[model samples]
Target: MNLHLHGDAIPEGLSRRARSFVASHGVRADATPLEPYRERWLALGVPGEVIDRAVAYQERWGGLVLPPAPVYECGPRYLYADVPEPSHGGGWWFVGGEPRASVAFSFMIGPNGEFGLWGDTWAPLHASVEGWVESLALTHHASQWAKQVTRLHGDEVEGLSLDDFEPVEEVQGIVDTWWRGSDSLVALHNGEAECFSGRVRRVALVYSGLDKWGLHGQ
Candidate 1:
């Protein structure tokens, strides 16, 4: 299957606000020049080569910067290159920008077939995508996990940390193996979405807090 992927390599700690904003407002593909992302990239003093490469990558695949929206929380945003998917529980929204991987092209998949995430720098975000996807899958695999989480905490939402959980490699392996059979996956977020047409699925949102996620789409 053919796929196209588009995302931002945003700096840490600055993604939540962006994500919240979009979730509150909505996702727009035709939104002109993405100033927030561009400015952030420029501030990071990212190498021209990397910028050129990323821009070229987007151009080749029709990737676009996420449109500004009301703040949902704070952090990087991952707007799909296509429209949001309606199958999965609500839709998938991004709290952090796509994760980066050292490898140019690494394929990661989630069991639900919701969407894929990737990154440019692997070492740091190496398992980021796998972590996010696997974490989400954990709830699906063992509904007990979610039930326990909810029942244990009740509506109080106390002590829920994304960092506290670990990704199950075995489950990720199954998802990855399954993804190989398909050509591409459709990604959705904040009432908007995009399609990734490539072999690389490496983007991820660093889950610093549980509130970073919401049931808006669900």
Candidate 2:
């Protein structure tokens, strides 16, 4: 995944609010040091590159604060929820997420620089934090588009495409993934309603939360 970095290596394609948050609060080199957190990550056996990338992100965005509401409250605090070692084992380090969601999912990274969605199950996602950032941008765009499409079509949001919205090169992969897989776009509609009913019940992409992937409804 190619992450577009703006000045100071801040990944582009983040929501406007997210970008602004970074602009205002992201720590610079001269800001508060993050060595303590780095030490903690190191103690947890997180890889050096991953730790560097994460710390660089903290310095750039002032520590992983996500958008408000449904979005998970992630940051250094959540990333380090477990110290020494993650409770889940498998050399996975707990990252962050909302545990109360219908499908509880959390972010995790393996010692080999593999990042993934970890719940009661695990789903590999990106190869690195950088890739994860790119995926996050795509997920954010897809979720927003899904919301708008749902509003516009009401009960008929199936087969929605980015063409319906402004063209975004970055989201092309997500769109492709959605179109190619039945499990990609999971919707909640009245079971009684006709399948493919044009009614816009509720539409959600697999990677909506940046933590949850595929179906959690089981």
Top TM-score prediction, candidate number: 2
TM-score, cand. 2: 0.40
Let me know the TM-score candidate 1 reaches against the reference structure. 0.24
lDDT of 2 by residue, 47-153 (tens): 66555644544444333433332222221221222322343544435353223344345555545444455544544444444444433444444465332322222
Residue 145, candidate 2: alpha-carbon lDDT:
39
C-alpha RMSD values across all candidates = 17.4, 11.5
Best by lDDT: 2
How accurate locally, in lDDT, is each candidate?
0.27, 0.39
**Which regions of candidate 1 are displaced past 4 Å?**
1-45, 56-77, 80-126, 144-147, 150-167, 170-218
Candidate 2 least-lDDT 10 residues: 187-196
